[model samples]
Target: MLSPAGDDILIIMERLGPVQKKILLLFHGIAAIGLSYNPRQQIWILKQIGREWNKINQQALNRAIKSLYESKLIDIKESIDGATKITITQSGKTKSIEFKIDEMNIKKPKI
Candidate 1:
């Protein structure tokens, strides 16, 4: 019973697989770019995801990070303060763009 846009997003998430989907969802959900700068400086603190996604545990998140890193979907860099920053990579950007396009197309009303 999902809308076309919702279905499109689901398809896109499926293409990215479970772990990447979680990471991407968390990133997009928080409207976050790069790393967070508060108390949990270097850590990948997806507090919302942690609370909302009951099926995903700390170990799952860790594996998702590793998969994203290895696949070049995301990059981890050390800041001047030695804080690790997570950045969406070029491929990730492209995929995001494609997802947006697909979603937009899905949202178009039928004539």
Candidate 2:
């Protein structure tokens, strides 16, 4: 797991469906955000991202999370508070960076 101090994500994007990609990105973002602060509190990145998604396709979010866990790109650890804890693996961060760079490199339409 890349701590809040790290910065990067990549190819995992290619293997993921759009929903999965979105979920992964959200985790990456949250992890980055939390690292800058000293407070150590559990944050549920998966559910937070899932809630931001379209309500009509909620099943898709669930499936995406299941896939991510199965692939070992992210972990959902048990918490004493009974809350979910999501963390992106190093592989996942590398893949997410790949996706972001690819997206940034896209040529814009000549309007």
Candidate 3:
């Protein structure tokens, strides 16, 4: 049996699971890379990292972009082609670095 406080803790823990953290990292990373490119362009660079790691598809890509944009990790501008371009925010850069550090820490083997 779980107390109310325990249930709240469980809910918070469930929200920050491995998969959610990875998705957040990937979305920020992608936004960072996009910001390094032409912002006015109709197309954004779609790297193979997500496919390599998780077999990403169109819907997943859309979801990630939407999530990041809503979180203000990236800014979106519509192009003449009616397509959206992404630019990473300053906060996104900081988050990206933090994510990289977290990845390095996780990948490091126990001594």
User: Count of backbone clashes for each model?
Assistant: 0, 11, 0
Any runs in candidate 1 off by more than 4 Å, and if so which?
1-16, 32-55, 80-82, 96-111
- Model 3 vs. true fold: TM: 0.48
Q: Rank the models by TM-score, top first.
A: 2, 1, 3
Extract clashing residue pairs from model 1.
Answer: none
Candidate 1 structure quality by residue, lDDT tens digits, 1-111? 757754654454455766566566565545552445664632344655566577777788788878778766789988898898897766665555455421455457789
Model 3 gets an lDDT of: 0.57
Off by over 4 Å in 3: 1-54, 101-103, 106-111
List the candidates' TM-scores in order: 0.49, 0.60, 0.48
> What alpha-carbon RMSD in Å does predicted model 3 have with respect to the real structure?
8.7
Query: Between candidates 1 and 3, which one is better according to TM-score?
Result: 1
Residue-level lDDT of model 3, residues 1-111, one tens digit each, is 756754643443343434434555666656566576665341333444444346555576677667667666568899999997677666555555554534474456789
User: Which candidate leads the pack in lDDT?
Assistant: 2
Model 3: which ten-residue window has the lowest total lDDT?
40-49
lDDT of each: 0.63, 0.67, 0.57
Model 2 lDDT-worst window of ten: 3-12
